[model samples]
Target: MNEKLLNNTACAMVAPGKGILAADESTGTIEKRFKSINIDNTEPNRQAYRDMLFTTAGAEAFISGAILFEETLFQSALDGTPFSKLLASKGVIPGIKVDKGAKPLAGAPGETVTEGLDGLRERLVKYREAGARFAKWRAVITIGNGIPSAYCIETNAHALARYAALCQEADVVPIVEPEVLMDADNTIEICEKVTSDTLQAVFDQLYLQRVLLEGMILKPNMVISGKKCPTQADVSTVAAATLRTLKHHVPSSVPGIAFLSGGQSDEVATAHLNAMNEMGGGPWALSFSYGRALQAPSLKAWGGKVDNVADAQRAFHHRAKMNSLASLGQYNDSLETVA
Candidate 1:
């Protein structure tokens, strides 16, 4: 394994004033995004949609890296430039999504464990050849009545560690993601406790599997209230709780923590991240690896129309810029009213 390469890429992924873009939506996922905009989810459309985001005039200024699905990694832009090459030419490292999506855990009725380790080593080699320097694997932890059992957390953690080990062996930095979903009606305190337990379990397994902590990035959900909760925690509260949780479990050796939006709105997510950065002095870089939070506005602007490309790019660039400022603790709520 090339420890230096992995660490360098991981650090670059969360460099100051920048964060990762999760353009790795699966076909089924993109279909939903497209449906919202009245566009078909064909391969050509998918390519064009992502092409718009990748080719956005100066998005590279804020987007340090982009995680892509396998099809996107191997596909080319309208001018025939491979998507990975296109990103690299603009100084953005390319990454891949290796998880097969979370599936129902055997005995845990409502919990899930992310799978994809079946033949990951070989897949990593191909992904690397396709210009991927990093990869992501997500484990889902749902909070509810008598749920997120020790069994579910351990199984997912073991899988995440195994994947990280193989990724390091293949010289690819892995983004370890254990998302405790926000779909419930649970309070922020419950979310915090669950998030803490999950991270502790994941790290324990990572150590047991000998995954190099310095060679990977962590993509965790912020410690926030559930979507169906009676009231939501404001930006400052979420930021403080999340930072506390990370300091508690995540090793300082990890280069960065690129948080997942996990169902947060764009402005809300940006606000939370900004609040965290403004608070200052975490051991590792705190940034984003958002999907819908970064792309929703762009998708709405484009609506798959050729004439709307420029507008879509503008919307995309604006979102990226906002998050970039948020990463540096320079973002302001009033900036949302600009442009």
Candidate 2:
């Protein structure tokens, strides 16, 4: 592992007023987007969409880095410049999502284990050569009645540690994402218990695997009630729950904790993050690693029309700007989303 490179990469990832843009949608996932727009999910179309994001006229204003899928890491723009090179030229670090899709854990029923780490070392070396400075691996944890057994949590945590070890060995900073899902109808207390347990297990595995905590950024879900819980948490409640849970499980040695949107409305997600930053007393830098929460409004505005590109960029820029503000505890939903 190159300690210097790891330190540089980690610092760049969480630079103030800048956060990651997760454009690393898988082929199947991109296909769904194409479906919405009546465009075929061909390689060219996928490349174009991603290129639009990475090559957006002035993305570096809020985007310090971009995460790409394996295919995107290799594909080139229309003029033949590789996307990785394009990002590097624009002062944005290029990262890759190394995890294969999550699969259902045998006997656990509702929980899933992320599969990667099979030949991960070779892949990391090649990605490093191909211009990737960081890599991400996500482990999904679900909450429910009689679900997400201890076996499921431990199995996922072990895989995450293995992946992290390989990343550090190849000079790549690892974004260790253990998302405790908010899809169940559980209370905020239930969500906190599950998230706390999941993070505790993840860090334990990281320690056992000899991973360097300083070179890793944690991407976790904020502690909040489930979507159908009949009672949604207010911004302050969500902020308090998330902070309390992280304090109990996450160590101060970790450099940052970027929260995943996990099906939250863009405004709500930003508001919650901003609230946490306002309430700040934590050891790690708090930020975001959102997907849909960062892009949904822009996508809906674009609607896949060539004429909508400028509008799309505008929408995208707005969302990015708001989240950047949230990162600094300065976002006001009423100022942006509220009319």
Candidate 3:
């Protein structure tokens, strides 16, 4: 393992006032997003949309790095620059989503584990050669009655650890994400318990597989009430709960906790992150690794029209700046009303 390279990549990923841009949606995922905006999900459309985000002027100021889909990793920008080169030129490290989507676990109803280890080591070498310095694999854990069993968590944790170990071997940093989904009607306390258990399992596996703690970033969800929950926890409450859970479970040896926005609304995601930082953050740097929350507004603004490219970029820049301030505990709700 190239320890120095891994450590440097991890630190840059979670640098203060900056976070990761998860423009790494799979083809099927991007299709749904395109449908929402009444646009065709063509290759050109995908490339154009991503190109707009990557080439946004001054976006690198708040964006430390970006996680890319396989297609984007190999695509080129309008100016004929490879997407990875364009991002690096702007000082944003390029990364790739290495996991295939989560598949249902055997005999575990309502639970899924991420899979991509079949040939990840070889792929990592190619990805690195193509300018990807880091990789991401997300494991999905759902919350429901009699679900998220120990079997499910353990299986996913093992996979995550194996992936991390292989990544380091390939000299690529890994973003280990074990997301306890918030799609149910569960209460905040239940979310809390599940998130803690999931983190504990992930870390235990990381240790067992001998992955370097300082060489990876943790991308987990914040502890919050489920989408269908009758009562939702406020931003401050979610922030505190998330902090408490991470402190109790995650090791400080990890470089940072770059949170996934999960299913939160854009402003809500920004608010929760800001709240976490306001409360003095935690032992790890509290940053974001958001996909939809950072892209929804820009997608709407662009609507696949060339004339709206600048508008889309402005929307993206605004969200990036908001989350940047949140990373430093400097963002406020009032800024949302501007522009």
TM-score of each: 0.99, 0.96, 0.99
Question: Model 2's lDDT to the true fold?
Answer: 0.86
lDDT of 1 at 235: 83
lDDT of 1 by residue, 1-339 (tens): 988988888999999999999999999999999999998999999999999999999999999999999999999999999999999999999999999999988878988888899999999999999999999999999999998899998999999999999999999999999999999999999999999999999999999999999999999999999999999888889999999999999999999999999989999999999999999939999999999999999999899999999999999999999999999999998888526
> If both were scored by lDDT, which would come out higher, candidate 2 or candidate 3?
3
| Per-residue lDDT of 87 in model 2 | 93
For model 1 the local lDDT of residue 190 reads 96
Q: Residues 1-339, candidate 3: write the lDDT tens digits.
A: 989989999999999899999999999999999999999999999999999999999999999999999999999998899999999999999999999989988898888988789998899999999999999999999998898899999999999999999999998999999999999999999999999989999999999999999999999999999999999999889999999999999898899999999989999999999998999977888899999999999999999999999999999999999999999999988898526
**Model 2, poorest ten-residue lDDT window?**
330-339
User: How many pairs of residues collide in each model?
Assistant: 0, 0, 0
In candidate 2, what are the lDDT values of residues 1-339, reduced to their tens digit? 777778778877888877888888899987887787788888987776776676667768788788899999999976799999999999989999999989988877777889977899999999999999999998999887786789988999999999999999998999999988888899998999888889999999999999988898899999999998999889899999999999988889887888889989989999999999999838988888888888887777666666877777777888888888998899987768511
Clashes counted in candidate 1 amount to 0
RMSD of 1: 0.8
